[model samples]
Target: MLALERVSKTYPNGVEALARFSAAIKQGEIVAIIGGSGCGKSTLLRAIAGLDRASSGTVTLDDEAISSPHAKIGIIFQEPRLLPWLSVADNIGFGLADLPAAERRGKVARALERVGLADKADAWPRELSGGQAQRVAIARALVPQPEVLLLDEPFSALDAFTRRDLQDHLLDLWADTRPTLILVTHDVDEAVVLADRVLVMRPRPGRLFDQIEINLARPRDRNSPLFDSFKRNVLTSLDRSLDRNVPDRDATQGPGQAMWW
Candidate 1:
């Protein structure tokens, strides 16, 4: 239910973050975007969420052009941007201020319970650990029952165990709510396991290089031969994209240069 048509974003310094990047995502689909460091993966998410305007073309939701922050969209950033002054419950209900007290409370309760943090309702933001804090952030986003969920490296900073736990939690949430999901990540294995489709991007004007569909069944087998094959293909595409700057060499390059694969 989302579409990007020739979308491009350029910074004030004239660096093109995106170049004619386009994609059409169906409702309830989970898509992952993987690419090199400087690619416009995060930039594309901002444009779709209407957190920033594109330099050219359009981002549309349900066929309507999105110009600014809209109710249909929800985003979770790398850091849990919780207000330390607010309690867990209050932070979740922050977006529901216009609703009646009872309705807001009910909404927050359901969201907290869904994220398995109902007990933390009264706890202050400072009292929660990193994973707990991120769960609260997810709860806050889901409280609005958004039509689309955008996660920009939401689990990147957490430890391996915590990240895996949250990934399963996220899938459960998505299965329950069925919101269109877009995840920007660097880990190929993570992308393969989590996405219905993985879009690999190239930098230096960041654009879509390949759209790899993961036809594997749910609860994907990370050690399966097919899974490894998909990961290899994604890595191969990434290696090809690295030639955008530093031509491919048979030997390793100096620091700050792209490593040849």
Candidate 2:
């Protein structure tokens, strides 16, 4: 299990990105964190991934302390970050730095197979489409079979159709490997469809607002009444967030405040 305890980040420019942020991700479970803009969501992901150090907190994987940089944990950021000069196979094997040539080749082949890119092994990053590049990024992260997979809005930049396809692909990958997955996203439907638990975060000093357990069955139906109900609840929570920010003007209120069942 990966745990974050009382984690806080304070930049030199006097920006408080995170404050007392605490959350834990268990083995074989997918957890999604959702929040508004500038809510420290990305900061939280970076801290857990060990890309950025927390000002005051402890990050632990199992019983071992993670105080410094480590590589067993893999992070996929918003951008693909693929190497322009390297082939798809070579890019995926970039993380296997210390392995021997023969072992690296085997691992690279397997990783490509996992992401369904075995046939495109010789393709360059520029030659592949956006979705393909992202898959390469995922393959790179999965090559080592990481203990924890940290994703920060991996689908945010893609178009709607591509986003849905990638989401399905990610679920399939997770089911096969069963890595502890933690995704940070802004879309509530994406959170509901992808995660076991949806963690709602509030902005301005970013604290946990709600932990809504997704009780819907697997292969969730986005158009069914059950899925509609789930979406309604999340929208309600989002509405509450916006209401809190608006001024107390009863005359200016709209009529669409009615709650859905």
Candidate 3:
């Protein structure tokens, strides 16, 4: 399991981005973290990725402390951030340099086929489209088979159609390994479509406000009433997180409950 115990972060300039946030995520679960600006969504993700250390508390994967980047953790940013000089195949296999050449080549070849980029193996980053580049980025991150993966608004830069396409594609790839996924996203639809549970955070020294469990099954219907219901619950929670004055709908329903079901 991946666990965050009282994790907090305070910048050198005295800005407290996160405060005593804690959650225990099970293996192979997909969890989305959503919140308004300065809510520490990215900060929390970075802390988990070990890209940044928390001011207090701890992040551990399978009981191993993570104060720095660990082999078990992989992170993908909003941009592809691929090396311009490297080919698509090379970029995907970048992390497997320690492996023998034949092993590295075999893994990269399989990843290319998996991402449907086999024909673009020799293509440069500048030569690919926005969506294609992002696919390459996803392949690179997944190729390492990390125990946990952190995504920070990875598909935000693409068009709506492409974004949705990649979302489904990501789920397909995820099924292959079922790694623990921790995503930070602002899109409510994206959160509903991809996450098993949606974690809503409050801003200004960010902390968990509410968590809504999405009980819908795989290959979810975007137009289904249940999906919209979950979306509304998340939106309502987001509004309340930003401003506590927003009246709670169905006050009897507890946090993490799917009211429609």
Candidate 4:
């Protein structure tokens, strides 16, 4: 499991980005974090990725503490961030240098086939389209088969068609390994389409405000009534998190029920 215990972060300039936020995610679960601007969405993701340490509390995968970047954790940002000089195949195998050359080649070949980029194996980053580059990025992250993958608005920049295509493609890849996926996104539809649960956050020293369980099944139809209902719940919770005056819709189960702190 991936767990965050009383995680808090304060910048060197005396600004607090997160405050005692906590949650425990089981293996193979897909969780989406949504919030208003300045709500520390990226801040929290960085803490979990070990790119930034929390001022207090702890982040752990299974039983191991994470204070620095770990091999078991992989991160994908909004941009592909591929090496310009490297071919698509080389970029995907960049982390497999420790493996023998033949083994590395085999892994890279499989990744290329999985991402549907086998034909572009020798293509440079500049030669590929936006969606293709992002596919390469996803393949690169999955090549190592990390225990957990952290994505920060990875598909926000792509067009609607491309975004949806990649979302489906991502799920296909995810089903093979069942790694824990923690995503930070602003798109409610995307969140509803991809996550098992949606975590809403409050701004100004961001902290957990609500957790809405998406009971819908996989291969969900975007236009289905059930899918829309879950999306509406997340949207309403987001509004309440941003503005306290917004009336709560579901009073039965209070906010932060799934949170540890």
**Best of the candidates, lDDT:** 3
**Candidate 2 clashing pairs?**
none
Please, what are the lDDT tens digits per residue for candidate 3 over residues 1-261?
999999999999999999999999999999999998899999999999888999999998999999999998998899999999999999999999999999999999999999999999999999999999999999999999998999999988899899999999999999999999999998888899999999999999899999999999999999898988888889788878878555556552344433211
What's the C-alpha lDDT at position 159 in model 2? 88
User: Which of the two candidates, 3 or 4, achieves a greater TM-score against the reference?
Assistant: 3
Question: Which runs in model 2 stand beyond 4 Å of their true positions?
Answer: 242-261
Q: In order, what lDDT does every prediction score?
A: 0.87, 0.81, 0.91, 0.90
Clashing residue pairs for model 3: none
Question: How do the predictions measure up, each by TM-score?
Answer: 0.92, 0.90, 0.94, 0.93
- Over 70-124, each residue of candidate 4 has an lDDT whose tens digit, in order, gives 9999999999999999999999999899999999999999999999999999999
lDDT of 1 by residue, 50-159 (tens): 98999999999998999899999999999999989999999999999999999999999999999999999999999999999999999898889899999999988898
- The CA-based lDDT of model 3 is what? 0.91
The candidates, ranked best first by TM-score, are: 3, 4, 1, 2
In candidate 1, stretches whose alpha carbon ends up further than 4 angstroms from where it belongs are 244-261
lDDT of 4: 0.90
TM-score (C-alpha, index-matched) for candidate 2: 0.90
- Report the C-alpha displacement of residue 118, candidate 3, in angstroms: 0.5
How much is the lDDT of residue 223 in candidate 1? Answer: 80
Positional deviation of residue 97's Cα in model 4 after best superposition, in angstroms: 0.8
* Candidate order (lDDT): 3, 4, 1, 2
